[model samples]
Target: MISKLNLENILFLDIETVPETAHYSDLDPTKQALWDAKSRYQRKEEYSAEEFYDRAGIWAEFGKIVCISVGYIKMEGEVRQFRVTSFYGDEVKILNDFKTLLNTHYQEQKYLLCAHNGKEFDFPYIARRMIIHHIELPNKLDLFGKKPWEVPHLDTLELWKFGDYKTYTSLKLLTNVLGIPSPKDDIDGSEVYDVYYKTKEIERIVVYCEKDTIAVAQIFLRLRGDQLLQEHEIIHV
Candidate 1:
């Protein structure tokens, strides 16, 4: 049970991704054939394997992570004030800043990094990029292939399993079921790449990332016993 676990030292994190476009067309013959087949489906308004690469590259390019919003609640007197700090910047710089914060500020803290669907996507994506940028990853994120429950990592998605492997749920769906108000408005996951390309407004992306982090935190509180964030854990960039 999370109650048996210490909650005071936990940190929440979320990241945004776009398609990978660096020399996408330079695929080997076999991959090129596969790409061509997938492109045919995309032309037919069906799924596109190429879209996956394209999307990843898009995020890799103009997708400035812009903000890494963090939330934590510290006990304050009779009231708890939620503190949310949004670290913002270009992809390279922002990632570097996050690494510094994780190492310097969050290192000594016995806190768990929480996120939604972090196991399948967000965690690995961030780790790979950090490696590419030559930045050291926090110990929390280093648990890549470990069993779901074995590592110190806590994924709300995995928790949602509740010992049921067949019950797959999305953050949006869980929030709705739990009555957690959705913070999304201007942009969504699909529009993220387009918004960055059209307006180059990293704020929108940042806000989206903020909402995701909040959703993860909300899920954590919900699972912990219907307790919403107590203010200090809410950081506004």
Candidate 2:
């Protein structure tokens, strides 16, 4: 139960990423000239979109992070209140800002880091980028050398062990099963890059990240036997 968890010590985060470039061919390369003439920025030397999907890193076609959303919650008496702090900027800036917040606030003992699919994607991506930028990760996020289940990681997706191992389900699907309202209004994972680049609107990405965090929170509440906030109870923490 999250009620037994040290609420003040835990932090939840989610990230939105986009493809770096679209130059590689899934088929035979017909244009040696096109590949040579393209600017270094446009050239993706490490990985392609397919490879990105598999490898799951900065090299992945999702070149950079457009938004990083952090949700902090505490048991304020009998009620659990939450505050969402979203960071939006260039890749470095967003990562740096997030690191700064973690250093200032969550750098402590016995703090469990929670995220949806974090064990697989979000946590690793952030840690890799942070290391690339020479930023020191907080104690809670220092999960590089540990085994997947060995680390102090809480993934709601993993918690829902109720489903068959072959039947992978989305957070949205789990939310639906739990009777939680879907907050998936903004662009989805597919449109992440286009939305971030075309509109340069991090707010939309922020909302998307926020919805995921809130969904995770709701999922946590359900698992912990806490009262899930209704439509009207969503007053900002």
Candidate 1, residue 6: lDDT: 59
- Residue 198 error, candidate 1, Å: 1.5
Maximum-TM-score candidate = 1
The digit string of per-residue lDDT tens for model 1 on 25-101 reads: 65666765765565564445554555455454322322235456776656666565455666665667878877777
**Residue by residue across 1-237, what tens digits does model 2's lDDT show?**
557886667677777776444323422343323333432344376644344332222342235666787776756676666777678777789888887887777666576778888877788778777787787886667876877556777888777875456666688788999988786765677667656656667778888888888788788778887777654434333
The predictions' CA RMSDs to the true structure, in order, are 4.2, 6.3
lDDT for each candidate structure? 0.68, 0.68
Off by over 4 Å in 1: 20-54, 57-66, 144-150, 230-237
By summed lDDT, which 10 consecutive residues of candidate 2 come out lowest?
A: 53-62
How far in Å is the alpha carbon of 116 misplaced in model 1? 0.3
